[model samples]
Target chain A: MQGTVSVLTQIKEDAVATPVDRLVAATAPDMARVNELILSRAQSHVDMVPELARYLIDSGGKRLRPMLTVASAMLFGKGTGNAINFAAAVEFMHNATLLHDDVVDESDMRRGKPAARMIWGNKASILVGDFLLGQAFMMMVETGDIVSLGVLSSASAVMAEGEVLQLAKTGDVSTSPADYSEVIRAKTAVLFEAACQVGAISGGADTAGRQALSQYGLELGIAFQLVDDVLDYGGQAGTLGKNTGDDLREGKMTLPVILALAEGTAEERETITTALGDPDATADQVSAVVAIMNRYRALSRTLDQARVHARAAQRALEALPASDMQTLLADVVEYSVSRAY
Target chain B: MQGTVSVLTQIKEDAVATPVDRLVAATAPDMARVNELILSRAQSHVDMVPELARYLIDSGGKRLRPMLTVASAMLFGKGTGNAINFAAAVEFMHNATLLHDDVVDESDMRRGKPAARMIWGNKASILVGDFLLGQAFMMMVETGDIVSLGVLSSASAVMAEGEVLQLAKTGDVSTSPADYSEVIRAKTAVLFEAACQVGAISGGADTAGRQALSQYGLELGIAFQLVDDVLDYGGQAGTLGKNTGDDLREGKMTLPVILALAEGTAEERETITTALGDPDATADQVSAVVAIMNRYRALSRTLDQARVHARAAQRALEALPASDMQTLLADVVEYSVSRAY
Candidate 1:
């Protein structure tokens, strides 16, 4: 009882420091190595390969996925050093996907700056993406961990499939919530699942611990993506480094749009559809749609769904042995969801 | 003395049958399995994946890279069945490159049909290419052949770098023959080298046999690309199933362009430069450029360079144990260069 109370008190005190900050601090030395591996691996004799890769790699996104890998490995208190390679590979895979995604989505901005594709053109984006993926595999192979390589490679294929499906579903007003679930799972959660699983494997975890970490990562990823989708409509512009309503403009059938479509009146649905995929959709038009969404309590319901997944993520961590890292990981999941508020 | 005479006589007797025909017949059984594996691995729940993949796979480009893998493996007569997976993976990597190439080059025709990017947009081409590449690594990982995976993954990165280099050099009249060599080696030769090397490793080859096959494939690939570049200007339209002058229009600084730029008169240089990257350059303009190339013997010189590579390929194969497959592979090298004439 005293230990439990002490842990609770410590967590409450540490809440002032964001979970990500705490995780970053705890995993700082390991992450420095991962970051170094990532930058060095991204390098090539071809100047554009490094230049375009750096444009994206340096343009800030929270290195959250790789940090999860590092933290998961640290959770077991085993230091095999393979986790650094896995973490770097995970980041490479993520950046590769981003480079290609900007091309596929014809996105103009990423991480608050002009997309790499816009600067280097789509051809460079595609080839550099391939380079990074190749580098990712090379890093994994160098570690001699074929199992982790399989996890990461399989996750890569799933991510591409997800992108293709998302492309097919774009501007598709009839896209169901089920289809959306499949898209987000393949595109987002599987990498997280693999990242954590490989980290656990590198950390010398048992089968049960591996499974628990995998489940936790998957649930957290779902919650993370769900929050991202909601934030696209509701997030402050500076907060995300991307314009709000970009998803709606891209005709992405995200949860908010899907829910709003399901619950809106005929005229309201007409307004939503009109603004759904129109790139020239005005701020007034977006606000109008948001008003309709609010009227239907769509955004709140979506966040509610995110909370369910977040809770599931925390519940997954409960299966692991109690430790400060485990608790911090759970807190990270909570932080991921709370970003929406 | 009698044995040498008989072998020479047998080679003469076999000359009537084309080397590719003989090689195809010899490796038919192995290649069939490789083809089956390729088709199966290319399948996806997403309809577009299979549809687009098959469209390119079925379009006849001679499946040469995978065939090289199969033949190299057969040369050792040790059947681990791992060659089939490696062969399929080589094909996937090749196809993925083609898919992305069409998008990057903005090509209209591939193997006499419209490019995949034309039917499916650039986004599909990019995503499907990533999918195929993912499938390729997945196949390699499944074999647990980390050495071969390392080879292919490294080759994959080199290929991408070559492409980025080529993109940077496009339309640059200052591109040297050395630069051209670097481009072809990175883009084309490295994959050939890897395909054969991995096949040798899978077939239980020693270090020497592996090196011999790697050298053979590299030289053959260089010859193959040289002939390909020459054919873009000199071959009959239907023979190659692609229009001549594509490289010129696409601003590709192939050997002919570089040589013509080096040897042409000032006016000739002007004419070549003007038609170099002009997609809408008329047939007469292309004829004018070809006329300049003829005056400088640029096309013949390129083929001469190709023959040099072909001879090198045959020389490399001589280090291996003499077999019908070896003789047939050498003949294929001859056949590849002979296409330019």
Candidate 2:
């Protein structure tokens, strides 16, 4: 219990250190625009088709992806509708991803409720996700920014390829960190980079500025995902949502677990690897793996790496002109590391 | 045998007759631009995700949506990258729809090949489709046509809602023809409308030209879809890849099926209504339903309606100045009616 407390304490510190909150705060204008777009655009959908889509749109999510998009755009300097569209587009894309992810994961639960796949069925979830994706694309097209469109499209393609690669690699225990990064980059970070890059381009940043924001987003996305994975084992009841160590029970090879398997004692490694091999591993087995991970301080090591990436992400923002947007964008970096679960 | 030959002869005549061939020829220039955009815009995706995305894209498709976009643009006397992007965007949207459609239908098939969901698993298929959707939004953003983007996004939302509506109404015998048309418009025609609307906007068409092309697409899309339903029952095997009565097997309610359900004899209606309820109904039941539809001359009625829509679509073309592209677009209207299964 003491050990878990220390881990949680450390996460909170890292998350509030600097960049994240500022970045988030600086995106105020974009946020307002996003609210307008969400209300107006979603209401328009309700007008045309009514009810069904509104249910999915209104379903609760933190709207993290869209915020990231707007923040990234603002950090580039000024603001525009392209960023607004990017924000909404990213959010729509994220939601579409979630709907499909729930189906693919065959996860019956998400947050504290039954997954959309469970309530709506895999078929409805999948098709509705497709429709949302179509909506996302259409939003992007309306932005009329070729560079922005090009980057996002390429990101999307990479994201899908990465997803397919991960699917092909599922249930395999021999996956490497490099492979995992490649997969996550496509699955999670491309959009992050696209959001930032789109923002930078719209802000009239030079090539260097765009590249820096893109780098920041890429690294931050990886760090965010790493922290999220770590939370699967390390989080408390509230933050973790479902069961602690749920990812292991599902035979997921997340960072700490993977690192622990590499560094743990022979017996510990065997048990952990065995659980990964067994798709039907119980919660006890997952918890056992979690304990072993803690013993090796694998979670700490993973956190250390995430912090390093987060710092790098923060540093990338140094190139941007100092402004309220820049400060808020920077603060977001800190906040990103703070969510333990 | 005589009846089959006569039908085959009619199919041959349909293929040869009307404006589709001429339309394809006229739209060649803009379509060429569409091809260029595919190579350039989808360059990164095709390069990075070639292995994953090539499978579906290379699969046989008519490229009709893209043609609508290019044709609409050319009709307005503006041949620019906007039209090309719009064309590519529509194609991307169309493919995304098909990917999800196969997943929802659970048929494990598409155009005779194993469905993406079947071959790659639902997870990969679903995610990749999403990636394409993002790619499309990115394309729209790059185009910098806010109005067109709005149109595309709106269509995307409507399309999703349409699918959800269909899902909700599936296997329910009381689904009205109006509701069925709603589904067709949302799921299919919206893309067509966007394709043409984008084309006109990108091609520098005046407001009048844009409105005309938009109307043309709306009508053409409806006509095309109506004709498609008719072909599902009576189209030649050589052209329409799937077996006849597939829609009936799936319990879908297209216009012919809906009209037949409305007009058929009590006994005939009961047989179809029963088959619609039983998802596992036998091949013989499917055949029986088709026979009942034939007895009701449902396809004839549907064909007549399609012709009317085709003429209406052609009327929209009259706003365009005389050009090969305009003529070809008009040709597409006639071709839509005559397209075999």
Candidate 3:
């Protein structure tokens, strides 16, 4: 009983220490180069390209994706400078999607500020997103590694497909868990998979190590998104960097909504459908939906789902030769799910 | 007098022959492969990809850029098979821009059909445009020519910069002719230049031949856009596949508008500005603007500028060896400007 309590206390202590912090500290040297490359590449002879790009790039997001790329590269202890390029490319791709997503979703705010679209208008947002995408490909090509280029490019296409699929399923109550899985995989996990895989490639990881990192990224990304979906209904707005229930207001068919709808009673379904996609849904209605979700443990179930993937992510890391970087990556996966708890 | 009349008649007959038509006929065999590649590459496991893609790709915009790529490749007759891929990538880039352009312009029609956004909504249009861009890069990477990839990627960045610049300058009457030149060059000419350059690279053109084709494409693109600017004010909807005076209504600062603004009286400038970017500007207002433009010979002046570029395009080909394709290309430049006459 004493051992169990001590282990639980240790886990709680570790949870407070974010995996991203460790990842950042470990990869800080390369990440500085990545930041420089990102800023330099985002620039253009045309002033607006850099201005709108900097708005999103400098928004102070954790830069988690690029950190993953840099950390994955560090795992092999290979000093190929290509990781800096891949990290920049990954960051650019993520920012491009955010800019475009804000426009498509008519999102007024991102990262707790007026979106690029809100400041520059939708046309500028769309075009600047294209600029970042162009820059990303340019950086990848500069590495002169066609194989990594192929991986990133293919991920780019799949990410678009995933977004379109989600757009297609928006507001439809019949969206299956399987469909939700596909959406999250495409929209989130694929980039993570590509980011780490490209980093591994740049780091001179052999086929096995590359595949292992790819799996780790994929599972971690899935957990990350599942937790995001849960947080939308249950997390504080400050914690989320946006409104608490943006997914609900956007009519996004996230895992929490999917699972809740599957298990809710008819009256509870009515409560959710009434509020789902209602950009004007009141706080009272949100509270009511949360009540139902709690009664059915839907939020907990979503977190449970995230935990499964988080564990899988850690398992994938076991395939790599054990290192401090590997241990830190595994802990980050746990912290991803712990955000909900 | 008889000789002069005979020569004039011959020039008139040659002016009726379009360069695009000649190039199209010459490159018909290779273009079939390119068309096949375009159709195949546009497919996705996601159903919306093909539906939205085909809506714009099949709208019949002459596919002129892809034709330039194929014709440039055939200049060397090397048959490296990279031309088909380059041609498809060029076409995809063009179509992707058109999709996003329709959304940005809030255009109601394209190729005499309701815009894809009208049929599928803004969200679909934005996402599908992204898919096509992703597919374009995928095809470029598949060619395994990093040099050509760099060319297309840089062009992609410049094109987006141009569009954003245009967006920033939209509805601003003070936009300079120099600024207008930069906009058109970045927005339109860079793709044409990249398309032809990539084709030359793939076709194994000598340095002189490659530079010749690059110059030829850049000049030809400038001429093509100048003619388009003229046609926007003067051509019938049948020829334009869009309403005349769209530039004025959209507040676009095309050459005719810029020249007219430069030379017109204060009242004339006021008359143009009243209708400029006025979505409700009527046919009478359009006619009034055209009257002022004609009074100053702005339309004629615009066409003259186009002719300079067209002739320069032909001059660029003089650096290359004389071939049937070369003569046809020169004739096409003449035809490009002759449309106004």
User: Which runs of model 3 end up more than 4 angstroms from their true locations?
Assistant: A1-17, A235-242, B1-17, B78-80, B235-242
Could you tell me the TM-score of candidate 1? Answer: 0.95
Which is superior by TM-score, 1 or 2?
1
By summed lDDT, the worst window of 10 consecutive residues in model 1 chain A runs over A235-244
lDDT of 1 by residue, A83-163 (tens): 999999899999999999988888998988999989999999999999998888898999898999899989999999999
Q: What TM-score does chain B of candidate 1 reach?
A: 0.94
Q: Considering every candidate listed, which one attains the maximal DockQ?
A: 1
Per-residue CA lDDT of model 1 for B222-340, tens digit only, reads 99999999899965221332387899999999998899999998999999999889899877788888888888888888888999999999999998888767887898999998887
Judged by TM-score relative to the true structure, which candidate is superior, 1 or 3?
1
lDDT of candidate 3 over A97-165, digit per residue (tens): 998899989899888899999888899999999989988999999999999999998899899999999
State the lDDT of candidate 2 residue by residue for B1-341, as single tens digits: 23323433454366664565554555566677776666454444323244445677777376878877776665555555787787888887777778778778877677778887776666666766776666776677667777887788778777888887777777767889888888888877778888888888887788888889889889888888888887767552312234666677777888877888898889988988888846577767767777777677777778888888889988988866776566657766776677753
lDDT of each: 0.87, 0.71, 0.84
A-chain TM-score per prediction?
0.94, 0.85, 0.93
C-alpha RMSD of each candidate structure in angstroms: 3.9, 7.5, 5.9
DockQ of candidate 3 compared with the true complex: 0.69
Ten residues in sequence with the least summed lDDT for candidate 1 chain B: B234-243
Q: After best superposition, candidate 1 residue A312: deviation in angstroms?
A: 1.4
